[model samples]
Every structure is written in structure tokens, then in C-alpha cells.
Target: MQVKEEKEFTIQKRRCLVVWVYSLKQLKTLKRYGLIHYVSRRMKYVVIYMNEEDIEQSEEKINGLHFVRKVERSYRPDVEMNFAEKIGTKAAYQYKEEEGFEVEEISTQIRLAENV
Candidate 1:
């Protein structure tokens, strides 16, 4: 007997994307998921999204579904850059501190809010 290994939950943001399917026949089945953003029968593709927590699991499941060709990760320049900016938010603070400004924590409270 083989046991399936599970992936650990990763800390991240939820993402939306377009999924490509092998055929229109599979489109109906995959569209059953409400998260599907849209489906293009002419192009033979579907768009869907889910929280980051479920992304890994979903990709596996979706790909395993019959006639699923691929899940396309959509690109959003603004969103990606914003995330990068969030991670680098303290960069300017360090520069200010180096310029003779006293270093201090503006807010000690840890906020997990994605929107700044």
C-alpha cells in the first residue's frame, strides 16, 4: 500500500489565474468550481483563482482532472510589484536612519494586512 504525502501550508497571498485545458469538453467539468474566473471555449482555456493556502492542492487536483492541459499563472505587473514593495518597505527607512535620523519602530504592531 502506498501513502500519499501532503504538502505543508505555505504563508502567502491568494492569487488569480487563467487555466488552459486540453479541450472544451473538460471546460464544463473544471468550470464546476465557482472560483473559475472565466472560460474561453474558442481558446480552450479557463481562468480560476483560490487562496494561496489551497493553491498547491488545487493545482495538483486540477491537473489530475480528465483533459486538463495546464493551469496558467496570470501575470499582474502591479500586484507583483506591490508585493515586492511590501517586502522592501523598510529599505527607505534604513537609508533615512543612515542619514542621521534616529531609527525607531513607527508601529510595533505586526499587521498581516496585504493592503498597505
Candidate 2:
């Protein structure tokens, strides 16, 4: 009997680069740096996803381009994404209802004052 070997698939960690540009025409040049994830026409920015290992070099090269106004690294990777610990905690559900007058009561009070 022949044994079948299973191959492991690995996903590379990618980080987003937010590049603000003067014009969208030079997008071809930006493609060489990383995978273009999103391009915002209205805001004039491009979101590029690059492998974590190559991000530093790509960031410098992308920033040196003439059309690029600024390049900012996305902080998504650094942020805490785990909410499992806090999900069932008492503190998480203990939000106090804001003490404010109800709209119906306020309207009734206003009507009574007008009639007086």
C-alpha cells in the first residue's frame, strides 16, 4: 500500500500600505511595489498589500516615487483583535443607560405648560 503525503499550505502575513497620490494615472508604477488591494478614486489613495518581510523596502521605494504624496503603514496588524475574553465578562454587559428625559414625557410636559 502506498502512503499519501499531504502538503501544508502556508499563508504569508501581509500589511497594507496607504499611498496618497497626486494623480491616479501613475498606478502602473505602484503595481511593481505590492499587490494593489484597493484604489479610492474620490479620496485619491491606493491601498497596497505587501508581504511583511518586504514591506520596509517597498515602503521606501514607493515613497520615493514622484506622484506619491505620502505613504502610511496600516496599524491593523498591531491592534488587538481578540474579543473572546471580554465577550461574557460582566463589565462588558454593564453599560449604564443614560439618564435622560423620554421624548413622550417631554412632549406631554410641554403641552401641559402651554395649556396653563
The TM-score values for the models, in the order shown, are: 0.48, 0.68
Q: Where does candidate 1 clash, by residue pair?
A: none
Residue 73 miss distance in model 2 (angstroms): 0.6
Residue lDDT tens for model 2, 24-75: 9999999988899999999999999999999999999998989999999999
Question: How well does model 2 score by local distance difference test?
Answer: 0.90
Candidate 1 least-lDDT 10 residues: 76-85
Error of 2 at 98 (Å): 29
**Model 2: lowest-lDDT 10 consecutive positions:** 100-109
lDDT of 1 at 86: 78
lDDT of 1 by residue, 31-51 (tens): 555377777878888778677
Q: Which model scores highest in lDDT? A: 2
